[model samples]
Target: MKQGQHKQTDPDPAAHVSAGSLQGYKGLTPALLTKLAKLGISNMQGLLLHMPLRYVDETRITAVRDLRSGEQAQVQGEVVHVEVQYRPRKVLICRLNDQSGQLVLRFLHFYPSQLASLKEGKQIRALGEVRSGFFGWEMVHPQYRVVGDETEVATALTPVYPTTAGLSQAVIRKWIAWALSHADLSDTLPASVSQSLNLPSFAQSLACLHHPAPEADLASLESREHPAWQRLAFEELLAQQLSMRRHYARRKHQGAPALKPSKTLITALLKSLPFALTQAQQKVALEIGRDLEKPYPMQRLLQGDVGSGKTIVAAMAAMQAIEQGWQAAIMAPTEILAEQHYQKMQGWLAPLGIQVAWLAGSQGKKQRREMLAAIADGQAQLVIGTHALFQEQVVFQRLALAIVDEQHRFGVQQRLSLRQKGGQPHQLMMSATPIPRTLSMSYFADLDVSVIDELPPGRTPIVTRLISDARRDEVLERVQDACMQGRQAYWVCPLIEESEALQLQTVTDTYETLQQSFPHLKVGLVHGRMKPAEKQTVMAAFSAGETQLLVATTVIEVGVDVPNASLMVIEHAERMGLSQLHQLRGRVGRGAAKSSCILLYQDGKLSEMARARLKTIYESTDGFVIAQADLAQRGPGEFMGIRQSGVPMLKIADLERDHELLEAARELAERWLETEPVLVDKHLARWLGHAEELVKV
Candidate 1:
């Protein structure tokens, strides 16, 4: 066999057992298999699904004389001269001659084997950008291959695949080609559905994407917008949608405690609140109420912008469960957030004669035991805690509802564990950081989503400003002025302690400096490194108005409600993510008083992305818009904090770019589920290797 070529073999009968089974592949060592596994390629289907990262257009080779400077060109030539020279640097130069002209191939670093392969009279094909070097026309470190004959030159666009260490692109391409030739390429989608959507067959799409014709649209292929690309992207998205629909169907079959909407507690709690619920909140509350009343388990996602009153909506849902003689639990990601929820819930529910209990990792043995007993005995009508609530010792008498705050921070397994505490409980997952529509459709498809689109009445919009740290004294004067007026303020530092490497302001150092600068005002410090107790104490002081200025880190970004704090100064805001900056800005503006947020950054030191993030934060207060921009800038994986392991790894579909296809696929999946439910298993088995595991999200 020639290099980068694989012989076509007959399809193995056992290949039908597993779509991409590697059992039939020959000459693969255990070490190579291990490396391939690390790249998530275990079988023939896996290899086929690994799409090319890019394509090299070598369909028509350009002669040396026809090559233009700054243009990528490929040429077939015979090596005429080869030498190693040490002038300004040690370099190897090989001269090649074609029918029309001669060109020079220069390599700053070359192995002995490479030098040996470039001996005189050897025929080679080189592809690279032509540059005007010291020689007439030179290509530095071009991709070159030894050719047995002129016919071996490529006649189609060459695929460049993503490979792991110890694996070459050629090897991956060869294996993928082999798999393509031998593996079954049967149509997974129904003929009626494909025809309605104007989609090509699976085999046709894969062939076009992996090996396009010489006249294929290079731009379309590169941008992943060609008809063939769309066909594959749609199929991948449909597979995911099918998996989600299946999971949803399975959950719908499970029985859950049908909690009644007891208006007694809900009415009492609402009457006690100083403000009335917003229209959006009322609408979502009704949705949640309806979901809780269903016999089947409710899997719902509640998304609201920061300070959008999600907690009140959650509290209302919990009250319904409590009124129905069942326990309710709320789980938060961090201890601080859990404590905040505990305090808020206690204040709200205690007046209604409903007992609210708190459990945290920081609790002592006696307190933890008491809390656990309260939960198990149903004495604690509503339980609020962190991951400690998921521990084996913590059991609920009848957990009718589980409210998870900051849902993205917790994985699917943690949510499952909490649900398992009792008969499948109606889960209400809350996220203050609004997700883009594309993400919500693909990642949260299994759950019904309700968004709180309106802010409460009498809430003031936060005025955001972008200023340089060079104006530090000006910012400090503003803070002092606000503090003098009896208004609390927050000065957030990105770092807890000053590091010589970063040179950014630290929480501790800023606290000391602010104390020294304004000797009359009290200042408190809080950071992640501080003990839970200490952090809570400092936070309490700030919330109680005992501290006029609080120096802290991002720990105070979420669930810290202080209406009196009208000023927010985020130092080194450029270092923060878009959603995070929005959250920090949300800390203020909760009161009716006019609030201002000052984003402090070092002058002229921001990267393009950082600059764009700060600009977006300054220009927009809409969380959904900010989230969309963040997704576009940082991608879904980083924006969601690497929790993508639970979601399907989409090979071709782009959440940002291919949102239309996602919607189409989702609608199609729903239709198929309603019409041909039996075929879902067969479709998923063909497209998704482990449909059960992939649908857990």
Candidate 2:
């Protein structure tokens, strides 16, 4: 072998046996066990499933002259000088030379043993990115070891595992090698299913991924686009689908009130509205109406664009349940939104002999007690509130329908707790934030989906404008013009209290500035810090056209529908997310007047991500297109909040890249579940060990 080449061996023959526990190995200590436990590696299978974050190519050695700046390479050379300096900072510098060139190695932090090993005149191998330093080519904090006569280089790429502070890469590699030799690496999927999908065997894929040969496609391995990676990703996605399906089946076994569709309240409510329901709304209302008639629990997600009229659909669903003598509850993520629902529903239902009760965290003890009593006595035919609806003290006599608005903003546990208030109550989740197709296939595979794809008639499309903060004076003039024209406007800011670190405009400051600039017009302010009554008062004035210009934070993002608010000017729009910007823009365009949204971004301060978000929002107003772009940019983890919730995040799958695999897995899981019960059980056991948390939500 010239260099960086060695003999290879076939994968161990223990592949037919299943993986065993970590305790089966000898020479285990308490300290090592604690570390392994912390990493969640209690068995040999856990070690194999712990994939590498990235791979380092240490399979080749380049000559010193061939080292390129900004490229990583390993070089063998003799150290000619070694010194420790203490000037601007304590440092150790070594000069190494080969026949082609001299290389400098600098370490800001070093060990005494490393100094002894890297003495002058010692031949060593160093691997790191080469960069241009003051002293020609250099590498900082490179991995270096003394060269010995019997030393052999690696013929395969090296893996950098996700490790804890105490667990070293060497220890993990040693344990994995042992497991590869002793544990069974059999395929979990059946032969027919695996062959139908054209996926590789589990044992072969694992071996190839862990020890990829030098000739293996380096780019594919690093980006996880290789077939070996795809095979594992498919298995992981299949596991997730199976888990969700199983929970969905369990829900199907439970009994619900079976509130048949009643037209008594539905007809009255529809006739009372000033406008008729859109075709899309009527269609989704029928879908929800039928779901309410099923004995099994209904878990449906009603999604639509902003101002698409989801609240009315939810109200229709609640009316059906109430007409069938079952109470309904609606929960919102914020006090502002919850109060909005309470007021609107009370207006529509109170005259129809329906008692709509209100509950919120900010309510006084006496008010809360009265609300709770009404709910317990079943006197509150329709209950609307914030997260207080799920609080333990607020008991519901008969809550058959549970509606959650802006559902994605809530954690899984909060939603689950509300459902537990009534035995197997039908759930109707509404969101203005559209879920992309890939996410609908993966994260929300279990639920039935109904999309109100059309906006009600007379609602004008919003004309989005991206303007630099340097032109903010023009935007202010536009806001003043719109307000003077007998229409309302919203000026949204990112922060409420002063944040010097961010140094962006705050709501109070903007409110004061607008008041000073336009003395004749009313410039009211509302933020999360305001008391609920104060916010309600300010918002009521704005909704009634008393406040011409409202300076607020994102608290007005969802469910604050003002038909006359025809203009929205968001300050520091670069600091907001795409969904948030879209929602804020939705605050306008609810009325027939031609609406516009001005995004005031600091041009010089815009990052590439902020620029992309603003460009996407400015170019298109379609929620689905914007949702796709947002998903592609932020990914499903941050986009759907899989990392912070009760759902189990995928171990080896990227929803963006492995969407095809997700589709395949979903189909296969459904088919296998219908026919191959034993095989499904075996595969789920292999993938989801003690994953009770996935369904607890």
Candidate 3:
């Protein structure tokens, strides 16, 4: 029979079984299945599809005498003795003896039920690492099987895979065996496409991967040009590219009504600022002003490093809407940040006689109701707050533009929800994390990018220092010295409390320690779990100088601007992602005061990736440079935990390695979708459908 058309002995798929299925297999319970499902594996096909990461070559058996001290080998011998060692650590020791020599199989922490199966005077085959013990040769924690009709199978090379907590390797193997026996293989990719791609038949690849006839087959799988991996990666990337292309094309062609700026009002507001706008700020602000005048609503991303004067650019955009007799809003990720922006805008824009309102969850019900009424009546020209802006109660007279702060913090759905408020609003997604141009093209291709690469003049570069935990006292003393001069300080901790799994400083614990050490200094604490109002109060205390030091979590990483704050101490700094560290460091260097950031890390051990990040931060103050290095060190997936950022996750395509392929796929999709528009061809529709599914992953 042809491989792809294999027929099952039983016509009923459910009635079929395999050689490995036991009438009552031990430990095959419903709980284990549920756990496996949580790991993204479900059903018989999933069991077989989860291929082994690697395979061990046990085809050649070695005698005990032939085993070297550091080699991994399979040895066969007759069981001479079996003993249970119950002293220091529970272990089951089995000794095997052949004509050549003696070998002991030690199983540490073995279950009592397993002892009955391993008996004395039984011939068995064992696979493990060979090591020298006091009694000579030994195999530690090895797999073994008693002499049986299928003993020859034990001598063959075995596949090893990554499994979850509750699933055992043996159980996974048995389930895969059942799938291989019962599953009716069907070819998904057409023969013409396979031939054009120089790919193997789907059935042959799957079967060869599961049960390779020879070691050469395994070697072929590892090659970069392997048909299975190449095809899978390409398909996954193409799907995502197609979705992005479609979205881009749709947005670019959509007609948007643009509003003209009110020069009188903008001039009045700019005159009230305590400081003059920088040249970089003026340029970006003017660019935004022009975009607002077009027939199409602006959908732009403002990319800038930390402290690169992006806040002013956002203000300029908001001013344009206000001048055109429309409302504008800025959405921050957190309440504290939202409140901070509200206070700043009130101080700057309120002087121009422009009405501004702050809407957040932490506000009193009466206050929120009043703000909503004001917005609906067109009394509020500018509004700033958290996600609460999208709630149905808050209506705008003319919501022309929406500015999202730290854009990555919210997902595409959340951002869309904001635009969907009233009619579609022009979006300006702003991010302080400077991503390289190449990576940004793949990740944010849906928006037009405007980068403010140059920093505002007179902004001092922060002095960075890497200090081991052993020098904690010196760092604390320096912080005290800085605070003595009326400079505010931020002590950032990795966690809120000590964890058994992690050895890092917690915010609450650090706050308590710092309070005790500096009794005279006022200290305020903030974290994610705190109520929004409470967080705002503490942040206000810090800003008002009621608190000289603020011990907080990374919640303050974005949108909390205190120009007078010049000192930053990050505990367990090496544990943070590069982008996170940069944001934390950015909390300082805002004011004219010479600022400094102390990265306090635990002494001794550090992973290579962590070391690279710490070194990069110390060597450069440029966020773009740091971002590029971070991307190279850790792929985009690991860089920011993209899932939490509301961004779609890529499965097989590496943003760093497959960037060129991603671009090509995007180009092809854009050209095809633009030219054909509807994907009328059946094959083309099928490809487009597959690509559409990838955009959401």
Candidate 4:
């Protein structure tokens, strides 16, 4: 057979056997199979994929006398004595002696069968952390296996697997070995591709990883950089890239309304703007314009830093839809953001005789009825709302474009539902949280990305300061001084209500305190728990400058743009995510005046992770750098909110460490898709368990 090609032979009967069949295997019981199911090992393939987290080096057994104080070692000796002591927490002590010296095996908890197995004069192989004990050098809870007189002592690394309470490493390894022996171990990748990449066959990689030779580099295996690990990671990344490329290709075949370039409304709106569009904004707007003009539906991600004027670019795209005699809709994650978009859209388009409608879940029956009717009749040229716009009852006359703001907050299904509402309308997703390059390439392979890398000129740079909470009084006094200077400020709390468990400051308590401190000044509050109308009212007051200070939760993190607000003080800033803190800081520095952000962390010792987060924020103002740091700290899943961002779950690939493999896989996938589209399904099936579900995103 070839290097990657599978042999053409009859399928092995064991290929069809499920993991539950393992109950018939030599040690596993029915109850144990049920326990294994909880770990997602339901079939033979699942068991194979449950790779070891790490390995124990038992290649060379060490003598008992040669053991160090704090080193993990493996030793083989004859059991000299075994006893169960009642005192000192019901201890079970077994002493083993070799030619060099004697070692004690202390088991704080053990079964009667374990005592029987460790009988006197039984030769046992023990592996564990060696530590100094009261008696002598000992190993607590060491993994020991009895050896018979004729049994061979192999010099091979031991695989340590992730297990639940009822399962043991020995049992898991035994079952895995049984499954591997019976498995057909077919080659998944084609010979040509594998040879070009110099990657091992799927079966070969699995075998090497499961049973690494003693000569294998231990450091490479531990760091997951061995050839076997690299092969698996590359295959996983290639599968994802293939799925995304298929999705991208499939969308190209779907028909959409080809919107023409806006000549009248867009020209007038641009002219009417108080300031000129930045070069970056103009470039992105043109990219979006070209995408809108295509017959195929446009799936593009518009990424810009906070206060980078992404909203205007979206407005320009919406205008293209309206000018072509079709309605446009913009969806935000929250009501405050939706209302903010609504107000901005109305201000820009209402003057051009465009009808803008607002539809949120909190709208009254009569108001919603009017808005729905206008949308259906095509009278509302542009509509701005939250997820409520995608409701079944809310029908659009002809939605030519659907722009989703902060797209990560919405799930793939929710966004797809909106697209299905209007015969595959052109979609534009916007994110103010600038995604790192590696993440954008992997997570958003299906969409064409346009980045607004430059901020619009004339915006003031915000000065970031990390202050301990012990200086709360000093910070509060500074806030008062800023308010007295006729400037606005935002005092953000992490929680809306005081949690006795967390002991963090609450928005309500902070509002009251600020209110009392500045009795003459107006204070506004907004949070997720507030009614939509009430929240809108408070936000309106804040924007109108009716309130000099807004004490609220992170609900004001995005979409509440007040250029005059020059001060941002986040209490318990350590509790907030890095991206969120950047967004909150972005609220200021929007105006010409100099701005300052005070990160008030709790006094005393903070975790190393928290301190790192604060230090990263303080050292950099670049969103891309901060995003990379956040990805490093929180990982791809949490940083992008995996489910919401529609990032496919990678089983083996690490986006941070395996970036080179990802790049190679992307190139190979693209080349394969271009040259041989017919084999794509086979490639996907071999690696991707749910390619169909991932493509829908």
Candidate 5:
């Protein structure tokens, strides 16, 4: 995105020139508008923000004689010959000469207007990739225009934009050029603020980006290290921060019923637990307790490493609400994970006279009805399920607290729907995939965060070993040994397309393979495609030690807890992301016996990225360290774990690369929201456009 030079004569440095709407532009057709809408652009602000993916040096022309095969070049010459041929295929051909040499212009697809435009003796300028054809050194379908010798070339590099199916670079370029010339290219940040942050003026930045001088550093531009790029990145980051803070404030003002803890159920549950709460768990639970006691709504993200006692902290938070006679609901992303939570909640609370219900899509009609009735009547004090808990039929009687596990797996609307299930319920979002520090500060700025940095005292440390698939038989023997030693093992298949059927097939095939190798060992197979009852049966068997080995997909990545299961084998480890591999590795190392995770990667076929990821996971058992490496390896977008459908994502700024910019934006956003509300409005309006409301939501 770019703007032109601003005159000091303007009364306000933050003066905004509205470009109005792209609909008012006579050059763009209705059909083109529809296509642009698919790309999330519908007006001038969006057009101004449409950045170039790359640029071409079309400012000069190469001599016809100097043309080389496979080089993209622009050449000018007189059209001396022309003809249409129909031998193997109908084609139009033209020959041009510019004194030193001759060049052939080939067009396989042509119209009569093109033929008439390429008449002999007309000087033509053509640009495209040069390649060898039947005629030596030819350019097929080269863009050309009949010209006079006096015609001058472009002063700036031609911009190529990211476009959709029916859009053209030339058309987008034309619109952007018009926007640069006409749109209000004024600064949104105050001059004092930009100067303090060492950022460039908005107008200057836009001008440099849209029409860089011919001698500009293209590498700097392409890599987005140029000063102009930083300026735009800062603006976008600022808008997001402001939007988040405003949303946070808006929610704070919409007060909720404070779920003050009577400590009756909590004290009972704590006394009955087999283990005491870790210090970190107690600290975080206290933080959550303080937030829930406030009259305002609590939107907190509870982050902890895999198997770091987050489940108990969530249970502790739920008891606070339940003690006040209000219902509490916990939603997990998958049925397997949800069922585990249900079983645990049932085990912990059922004895304390607390009713817990399970809601899932695969439940039988009669069972689902009973669960629904219990939830609606407030008889079920603690409810846990997959996304089904947020469905229309399941209404909470007095829902005061909502806990979501693996929160990133849910969509924006799904999360929002769950929030709306109660009248401003306090929300607790739990994640095992740790958020990188900078990401938590910037993208997740709105939510209060509590981190359980300490693991429980008695958990065993996991040893990660990388082994090639070439030694598959050796790895199989290791699994057999572990299972035979009175310990359980997990053989996890790679997630194939994230489709339930495909994942089921993957685990089934793996199950069959292991069945032949270990016919004596009882192995259980579970996947997302199985009915809830069926999955529960298999998981129950594994938990009860009836099954010695379990072969499953990533469904076991989060909530399947068997302290006796100490060995984890992840197939195609090279194909998985670092955080995913880390989570999978965490499935083991829960018991006192020394645990080991074998990363079974294909031999001699690992890509550089995959190799780096495997190495990162193998080197560190610390979730935060692995998380930072994962962020660097995959970039913040993928590392965020939330899908694009959840929120408005960054367009220019990268959470890893531009963290300094983000930090500056974060500090400035908080200060300006109170001291300079006008500037914040202009900046958010320009950068956020139609996304202002979406980001707030």
Candidate 6:
């Protein structure tokens, strides 16, 4: 037997064992238990083993004579009067009387059926946490039972679990009770494994978790000091580390033919640039050149904040690939972004007579066929487009490099498809999101990272201002002035159309309003619901200055670039994440003209978190600082919907508190993989299994 477990044998094992298990509760009705497996609960054992999020200590009971202020207690007393308090909301108030004192039992939103259950002048037992008010003692939603049924009044510390709206504490407790009664007490782990780790068996742990007989039993079940959680956490980290290592190893085996850029050609390209590159940019270029010289393909990430000249750096890398007599391709996530990159590349690389062709979803069939032929025949030296570049028909002759824009948007399979073309191409993934160095190292350790921290010359810092609705007219006047100056402007709305729940201002409504405000100006609209061709047409008009003002959704956040656009207005800016806001602001400040971003927010009802986010935006335009602050304000998991990013999901390893643990785990994982490639040892194997389960991969 485990050291601190209950030693007493059941007086009547038959009485202890009950019938209604979770398996039994599955009565052909679709309830939480029916859908439990999808959320990782597999069996009755798994359901009962799910621990409570917190515990409520409803164990304190006292007589009316001993009742004190600011104490939580259950008391038995006679009822005096039942009345209803009607003010902000309806509440049921029952005044109780005892030998020495009186107290009020309050229930928020109590129904008539509840009042019918209790009779005045009848003895009753009240179980509630006490709060001292100005008039007297009050307990809200206190558990009540008949005076004679004292056993039913829960006097022990009760478990309170994380629950959905339809599930309540009583229902969960009943389910747990059912599970405990039907346990089979079978051990899943091998005896040798359990002996080595000195861990409890599967059945034993489950039983203890449901009905902990002692404090030690509860602690052991919680796995707070036990080796179970550590074992689990380690296992999760190891699986990710191993998966990354395997991917890296596989890439290395692809065999990249060594190709070095000609010194004279690279020197000529660098000298011909309009301005000298920043030191940080030069450092990154050198790294890329060095990687190209190696026989192994380069897999690197280029991360920079908004307006950090990342496109220029990418162009230089493509130039090097051209010098090596091999073709290069750049893939953007959207056609708009691809078109933007194509235009930028044409303006910059066309002077050198380097042929560049764009192939996207909207390309003409005959034109696409011709471009594909030129690419396969080694005529087009550089190709830039959306996913069209990765299609099976579009082949590359000796493709040497691939540049992926907005790397997060493309999945691993999509990126691999491009690299696998003709030959495994050297990869450079770029993101405008500035990830913290440590997180980047921990999350993307498999890939090398280069950051651009400097902005190019003549780029003006965008002034961000927060305005209340009272200043709506003033904001509109400013936008009107910016548009009248021959410079274009973008007005971003939160939603495409109206919805019942959100009440947010829609882009269509905003477009109509703005058109009336500026009668002579042409207004173009684009949203996710618009057809691709329609979107392209509107975007093209905006780019060519046919529409001086454009109203758009978040779709334009990443790639539609118009250098002359000097004004950006984002409505309900507080609703956006910091990274999203940064990307939106990046749309402007691409030109020599001064740009200004105005954030319009509702008055008087902003949440604390929303206010903080807006304040952070106003304080600085530094993306790195904003990223760090975002992590601190909302932990990495919640910074931007943890499900979307690959950041490790942790229960106890707080990103803020346990950063040290994260670093330690990273070093341990890397060393273990480097030394012991396979998880040969029993300890490491066990750890790997636990890690994989925790990450839910």
Per-prediction TM-score to the true structure, in the order listed:
0.95, 0.93, 0.81, 0.92, 0.91, 0.74
Cα lDDT of all candidates, in order? 0.86, 0.86, 0.75, 0.86, 0.85, 0.71
State the lDDT of candidate 1 residue by residue for 1-697, as single tens digits. Answer: 1234343343343444347457544455677678789888887678888888788888777888898999998888999999999998999999999989899999999888888788899888888999998779999989887776746556668888878887777777777877787777888777886787787888988898899888989899989888888888888898889887778888878899888887699999999998899999999999999999999989898999988999999999998998989999999988888999989989999989989999998989999999999998889999999999989999898889999898888877787788889868899989888988898888777889999998988889999999999999999999999999989999999987668998887788888899999999998988899889998998889889999999988988889999999999999999999999998999999999899999999998999999999999999999999999999998887787545447776778899778888988999898888887667766777677655446453
Model 3's alpha-carbon lDDT is 0.75
Off by over 4 Å in 6: 1-34, 42-51, 58-128, 131-158, 163-254, 262-272, 322-326, 351-353, 375-380, 388-400, 420-424, 520-523, 537-541, 544-547, 633-648, 675-697
- Quote the lDDT for 152 in model 4: 61
RMSD of each: 2.6, 4.0, 6.1, 5.1, 5.2, 7.6
Model 1 poorest ten-residue lDDT run: 1-10
Give candidate 5's error at residue 153 in angstroms. Answer: 1.4
Residue-level lDDT tens digits of model 3 in 1-697: 0012222222233555332222333334567667667655555445655667777776777889899998888888888889998888778899998779999999886765557756777787888899999789998888776665346644435667678875666666666666777665555445764576676665666666666654446675654335665555455455555566566656646565587876787777777676777777777777777777776657787888888888877987888888777889899988988888888888878778888899988889899889999999999988988999878777888888899998877766677777877476687888898878666776666567788878766778899999999999999999899889989999999898679888676788899999999998998999998998788789888888788899999999987888889999999998998889999999999888999999998877788878888999999988888999888887776664466544445654566666665666566556656564443232223333222433221
State the lDDT of candidate 5 residue by residue for 1-697, as single tens digits. Answer: 1111121221222334364556644446678789888877877778888888888877998997888889899999999999999989999999989898888999999888888888999899999899887767888988888778788899998877889985767667766766777687888887987888787898888878888888999999999999899989988888888988888878878878797865688899999999999899999999999999999889999999999999999999999999999999999988888988988999999999999999999888999999999999999999999999878989999999999898888777888898899988999998998888888987788899999998888888999999988898899889999999999999998753346542322667788889988999998988777777788899999999999999988888888799999999998888788888889889898878899999998877888999889888989999999999988887777776554535568888888778899989999989988888888777877877756756422
Winning candidate number (TM-score): 1
Tell me which residue pairs clash in candidate 5.
2-206, 3-206
Using lDDT as the measure, name the better of candidate 4 and candidate 5.
4
Candidate ordering by TM-score (highest first)? 1, 2, 4, 5, 3, 6
Residue 513 displacement in candidate 5 (angstroms): 2.3
Give the lDDT of residue 467 in candidate 6: 90
After superposition, candidate 5 runs with Cα above 4 Å error: 1-21, 64-72, 81-95, 103-120, 128-143, 495-505, 695-697
Could you tell which candidate, 2 or 5, scores higher by TM-score? 2
TM-score-superior candidate, 1 or 5:
1
- Judge candidate 4 at residue 7 and give its lDDT: 25
Worst-scoring 10-residue span by lDDT in model 5: 1-10
- Expressed as tens digits, the lDDT of each residue in 405-459 for candidate 2 is 8888788888999999997899998889889988888888778899999999998
